[model samples]
Target: MKILVINGPNINMLGIREPEIYGRETYDDLIAYIKEETKLLNIKVSFYQSNHEGNLVDKIQESYGKYDGIVINPAAYTHTSVALLDVVKAVGIPTVEVHISDPDSRDEFRKISYIRQACVTTIKGKGFKGYIEAIEYLVKHHS
Candidate 1:
């Protein structure tokens, strides 16, 4: 099984953006954690992070028949990008939306997720572990 992990916006600044909410894990640390957790699962996983909305959309488009599932953290775009929602829907990939911090508990704007409507499930507030949960869910359910 193959899974594509996509991170958006300021996610690359994980460690320095907001340590209080997102913890001190660097983006590389997050990737390592996910790799470690899924190492024994025998699933092929790939990762991509971009601050640009079009690049992310292109990645999703490119995932089309190449990936079995997707674990996405749209970050700031989660609340604003309809293009993301549309592309995910168009790709028809089983997607799981993930967040390092719980958007529902944050500001009113954060409570909205434009991509959630296209996802099979959503995981949040679990720190870097949330990516593991999302990947495992995809392997178990979509694979």
Candidate 2:
């Protein structure tokens, strides 16, 4: 199986952005972990992180037919990007939303997720392991 992992907004600043809330692991570390995990499952995955919402949306839209499923961490855009949601819906690809921190336990603004409703599942609060978890879950549940 093949998967596209898209990270949006401040995600490029992973380890440096906010250590307390987002954790100390870098996005590259998370990608390495996902790569290892997917290798074990015999799955292929492509990862991309962007601070631009439109670029992320493009990535999601481009995944249609090119990927079997999508795993995304839209960062701050998760609560704000209707464009991303539209692309996800239009692509009709299986998707999983991931977050390093549990937004529900944070400020109210961080708690709202416009993308969750459009995903197959949401994984949060597990740090970088969240991505690994999402990949595993998405692959398992895909027919």
After TM-score superposition, what is the CA distance of residue 31 in candidate 2 from its true location, in Å? 1.2
lDDT of 1 at 50: 99
Off by over 4 Å in 1: none
Q: Please give, for residues 1-143, the per-residue lDDT of candidate 2 as tens digits.
A: 99899988888787898798887878788888788777878888998989998888888887888999899999899889888888898999999999888988988998888888789999999988888889888878994
Task: Name the regions of candidate 2 deviating beyond 4 angstroms.
Answer: none
**Per-residue lDDT over 18-128 for candidate 1, one digit per residue giving the tens place of the 0 to 100 score:** 799988889999888888889999999999999999999999999999999999999999999999999999999999999988999999999999999999999999998
TM-score, structure 1 vs. true: 0.98
Residue 82 error for model 2, in Å?
0.8
Residue pairs in collision within model 1: none
Q: Pick the candidate with the highest TM-score.
A: 1
